[model samples]
Target: MGLEIRLLTARDTEAYWHLRLEALEREPKSFGESAGEHRLSTPESATERLTTNPEDNFVFGALLDGDLAGMAGFFRYTIAKERHKGKIWGVYVREDCRGKGIGRALLAALLEKIKACPGVEQVSLTVAAGQSAARALYVSLGFKTYGLEPGGMKVGDEYLDNEHMMLKI
Candidate 1:
């Protein structure tokens, strides 16, 4: 399969929304947002999000044979004091596509774009505890764990912890 990594655009809104909901539903504990919440979001919102500013906010998508299979996002903090930091969010690879390094390619592309943004010194992300593969991927990319947030998410009476990690660019 041909793998292509590129910034997502408004034209990809529908596919991106579907993939995001799939991520939320299939791996509920992996994200901070719930499928229920995402279901309430409109396509217009997704389009707006995809219409990003490369300098501060953007999403990278991995397409396998022209199909959206993985995605990663970045947004620099807007607050004056936190402007030097950015956060990675909504990282997911389709279950069928997991073993192909799509996530790594998506992240590497996102990180390369983040590095070009002015004043962004560090990038931060949170991975749900117990997700060994995801954590391992982040570590392989030079992310260092800084702390853990207990009970970061609650799904059907089960509390999930999140490990905070950061990479300095």
Candidate 2:
């Protein structure tokens, strides 16, 4: 897939908001933020949310046919002592766009961007434990499973385990 990956900014707020809401509603457990929380945000607030520090925080969008097909976000740990560690979050591709290497390409592009940030020695991300395909994709990209948080995420009455993975970039 000759996917066009772009780093989004404040100007892309509308598209980002819609796509993010879709991802959250479609796959709730895959994300930490709930759609309800995001629904509380107005377009004005979305501008603030979408506009982030370019050097340490940003989102990568995978565009196929000129549409926002997928997205992934990267951010540096905010704590002073954890400045060397970065995090990859909010990785999701549209259902129709899945299995086309879009997700993989988005991640690859995100890693490439993370590489440009000095002092970022390692990157970390977490996935639901049962998502084998996502886990395999991360592993193939050189991420190792460091730990598993049992019942890390609770969805209604059931709890889902989360796998913590890290890449020594």
Q: Judged by lDDT, which candidate is best?
A: 1
Candidate 2's displacement at residue 137, Å, is 0.9
Give the RMSD in angstroms, all C-alphas superposed, for model 1. Answer: 0.8
TM-score, per-candidate, Cα-based: 0.97, 0.94
In terms of TM-score, which candidate is strongest? 1
lDDT of each: 0.93, 0.87
TM-score of 1: 0.97
lDDT of 2 at 147: 95
- The local distance difference test score of model 1 is 0.93
Candidate 2 Cα misplacement greater than 4 A, ranges: none
- In model 2, pairs of residues that clash are none
Per-residue C-alpha lDDT of model 1 across residues 108-165, encoded as one tens digit per residue: 8999899989889999999998889899999999999999999987888999998999
lDDT of 2 by residue, 25-111 (tens): 988878778899888889887676557567898899998877899999888987989999998988989999899899898998999
